[model samples]
Target: MHRSLLAGTFLLLFTTAASLAAAGSSTGLDDEIEGESRPAPSSQIPLPQEGDKPEAENGEPPEGNVTRPDTREETPIPDVLYDISALPEPVQRMRKLLMDAARSGDIENLRPLIGTGANRTQMALGGLEGDPIEFLREISGDDEGQEILAILLEVLEAGFVHLDEGTERELYVWPYFFSVPLEELTPAQKVELFKLVTAGDYEEMRTFGAYIFYRTAITPDGEWLFFVAGD
Candidate 1:
């Protein structure tokens, strides 16, 4: 009975040893297959660079995009003024008066001087006063207004160039209505007259002129401005 038990124990030990050996061999085969199928490490893969980046199939920059210059250019404006002497005498006269009125703030006497011809009627003042410069801006309307302005500009240029030196003379070409003598105005007043004559025929000029003069004062420049407007 002892001998039979020893033999059975030996057989069991052998079977166990064989099973362990087969498992070791199967494990080694699985490891080899896994190593062959696995992908390479991330560091080994190729990557794109800025210069090497792929472009659109059509070769244009991507959709909804455009390129522009870094700097912008400025446009130039045109010169509009013509020679001063080329304008008519009446235009020249009106330009002078408008500028004169501007500097003086003389409106009361400026009204009757508006409109063409000796039989001219008074225009609506539109209730402006105190500042004839502002009035000159108002009375002159549109291109017609521009004519007055251009003329004034010409006269201004002329006065500055030709009459620049010597005694500053005020040209008294007679008032239209009252037979009052042309008063020798203060230098300040003379400057006002210069502005009135040159500020152009803006609507504000008329209103301001009327307000300043109210009754006695006359704009020697207004009639000529009106005549220029007609032409």
Candidate 2:
């Protein structure tokens, strides 16, 4: 009986050790897989946000520019801005206002771009689909949100270059899965895309196989609607 008890004890200890080993192995393997194909984290990295600046009454040079999201890792592209001059003056004005608010991460500043109370209407805000104020809070609180804001700003400023697998047409456009819908991504792109987009969008895209980024939709009348990113 004592021998049998000792044998049981040894088996339990061996099983526990094996379970731990399996867990560790699987964890390491997962990390390795994630590190290999995780959307390459866009081209740029994040920069820290700045504290509020004193108002620039009149044409004062304003406060020192907040260090925008760092582009240290991004391959340099030509500094060409899209021509919004042909757009209606109001659209131009609203776009400018929205760009400024996003760049500064100023929630109050977004008021002018968004409509007034009761009449206040913004079509959409985030990848997960939330309100503008909540969107502001989100980007304000998180570095990745800031990065998303920066990407939107850059796309607005200069048109984005669409990038697809094995394409050399690398225009000055924001990278996107060319032609293919977000819902139809191949197995490899799908794996790389898992954590890149919101879970809601990801699941939807998985069904659709095509994903679009830097999407800004305004009403035909020039009302600022929504801007969404990722898969």
For model 2, how does the per-residue alpha-carbon lDDT over 1-231 read when each residue is reduced to its tens digit?
122222221222112222222332222211111112112111111111233211122212123211111124354423323466754566676667768876885455655665532223322110111244443333222323454455446445533222221332111222223233455455765553333344454555455444433344333344553343322
What's the lDDT of the predicted structure labeled candidate 1? Answer: 0.26
Cα lDDT tens digits, model 1, 54-173, are 112222122210111011233221122335464346545655565665344344334434432222321111111123222333333221234234333333432211110132211112
CA lDDT, every prediction?
A: 0.26, 0.35
Error of 1 at 29 (Å): 99
Specify the poorest-scoring 10-residue window by lDDT in model 1: 39-48
The clash numbers for all candidates, in the given order, read: 47, 17
Q: Which residues of candidate 2, in runs, are more than 4 Å off?
A: 1-81, 116-131, 139-145, 160-209
Reference-based TM-score, model 1: 0.21
